[model samples]
Target: MIAAAALIAAAPAVLALDGTPGQGAALTGSVPPGTTLQLDGQPVAVAADGRFLIAFDRDAGPAATLLATLPDGQRIVRPLSVAPRAWRIERLPTLPRISQPSAEFRRRRAPELAQIEAARDMATDAQGWRQRFVWPVRGRISGLFGSQRIYAGEPGAYHSGVDVARPTGTPVAAPADGVVILAAAAPFTLEGNLLMIDHGMGLNSAFLHLSRIDVKPGDQVRQGQVVGAIGATGRATGPHLHWGMKWHDARIDPLLLAGPMTP
Candidate 1:
């Protein structure tokens, strides 16, 4: 917990960023210590030291307003400026069958989907998750958010989250205070042994390709608390942790939610 006066004293005179509305803009700014950031109504966890980053969703429309409220009752509002980009949308001329899962795979994927849905629906009354977030795992960043992806010679979906490539069996910690909404081995063709945590107000963190799960459903975890270990499960190429984050159903960059991650 932080004092409101300390938060007010640390807040910037006015929040400012270099970007346009509706475009996938990269926003870098500072909040007062223990303040919470809301961009287009989604919660962004700040660091204890007041540093934070947030990126607009690709589908975010133009003319979005960002709201940052200090614990002391000070508020900063900034209008987003988004630049236009030409997007290439096309239907594959010849889709591969391997891209589609087999019948047996589909049978096993149902429970995984159920677990994910349950995690997404987890509710909490406490708002302590608004505090500063920490890195769950520190390692080489093997992937980024919103990058175009190619799977097995077919154009796949865009990378919706950041990937921290740590060695196999390295412990993965909770990035923020949250309840373990789902903790079980999943059979998804892509994400195996998945774990999702709800940090309240629709902000959730997902750990994929886990080798071992340390927490269980409905368990409360704090920042830097070990939750699982990394592994080459599911469709992974090697041993690593695919850390993803979502605000409601909108996928956001986890890297944007924290300061520069160091291995």
Candidate 2:
């Protein structure tokens, strides 16, 4: 096993890695060109230039393995120590019921879920994950990723994305380059005027509770391009942008990509 380094010879090695190394963090790195890599037994997409990305889940354990096969048929396995995170826990005696959904709503869920799953399964040539992310809208952060909420002493769903509280009509921009995969011109039962973008290699971004969408499916958008506007169009209490990200089925933290909004 070799330690991660910024630059290494054309051998089985880790060239560069960035991110917290904790759950919900997207680990972006590189290896020698033409080398094959895998994360926890799953084949990772390595671009022609050897750049790769792997994101940890919210409940991911404290360790992961990175295996690389060199051009010379040699193999190297690096056991990575993933740091544990302290998630925010909110316990409330009384809260809106999120645990139960109507049967009709549940019936409609299958198609929506399938669409989202199919969108994230896409592996495109656009290298959007290598770019620096920008905030879709500058607003007060109302919620964070991986934060759990308990209602009446029962644990409920953890927040899957960051919530930015901005007034309706606030422009929401694309954080990176991508092709618009799902642009719901009509409101979704749960996500409202939903819009989703595929950033290649099984990584995707979803913008929920949108009031208006500026892009359509198949439209290629660049960094900082406006995709929609903030709104309380779904089950939200007030107007806000719910920015979520996923790498395949593993949900990742978007703030980890965009960082804190400029004060």
Candidate 3:
């Protein structure tokens, strides 16, 4: 299966790439140590061992380029084709419900947004991005990433995370080793009790609508460690864990990183 996802041509002498190059996919690659890497002209972080990670967003264009500049002035370019997926789109005949935000909501939401932005922007030394991710909780998938609904010709925001339906208080585990960046002390307007973890390499995970948070900011958590509990907090309708991930600004599909869930 991995071999199938790794669609690449001849690897250059200075670099090699692997993993899926599809939209919403993450690719891991390596280059000669000291090689500088860039994706679409943006500098990408390369570990001391030459390893690096890059990803395509769900709405990414058909192609991108990776440029590696070796220490000896050698340059290698790899053009990537991003395979697209058909998103699940639901259309309803009713008019979209638009409501004016309350003054209180507007006042409170600013700080919440600021806190979330600050958490995701933090850089940490955690190496969990190199590890294979695991399911935080196993259950029926309630919501899918990139799925959207439309009402009266108006398109709603696409789902940003994969939601697993579970009973309230069910423990949620860390998908990979990470440093806790934000463990919300109270429920936010939409996220409830949110927890953010930095897995390094510009990749991070956000667990939302949690009933309880077992970890706190600056805590180092390992894969499968309990970090929170499932809940119907925030704007959710029922108990579930909203597991969202991002590689820099690109929203990621947790189902891709963790693979098939098993008992």
Note the Cα lDDT for every prediction shown: 0.70, 0.83, 0.90
**TM-scores of all candidate predictions against the true structure:** 0.68, 0.91, 0.94
Best-fitting candidate, scored by lDDT:
3
Count of backbone clashes, every candidate in sequence: 6, 0, 0
**Per-residue alpha-carbon lDDT of candidate 1 for residues 1-263, written as tens digits (9 for 90 to 100):** 33444333222344544223333434456666887787777777566667555555656665665677767767666655555544334445455424467889888778678768877876764342466667788889888766664444666677767788888999998988888888775435678788888876567788888998999887888888899999988889998888888766667667656768864
Q: How do the residues 1-263 of candidate 2 rate in per-residue lDDT, one tens digit apiece?
A: 34455223433345567655888888788877897888888898888888888888888899987787766756666667888889999888877556578889989878877877776666667678888878878879999999998888888878999999988999999999999989886777878889999888788899999989999888899999888899888778999999999988788899888877788
* Sort by TM-score, top down from the best: 3, 2, 1
Q: Positional deviation of 228 in candidate 2, in angstroms? A: 1.0
Worst 10 residues of 3 by lDDT: 1-10
Cα RMSD, each candidate: 7.9, 3.8, 5.0
Task: List ranges where model 1 is wrong by over 4 Å.
Answer: 1-56, 65-98, 126-128, 150-155, 185-187
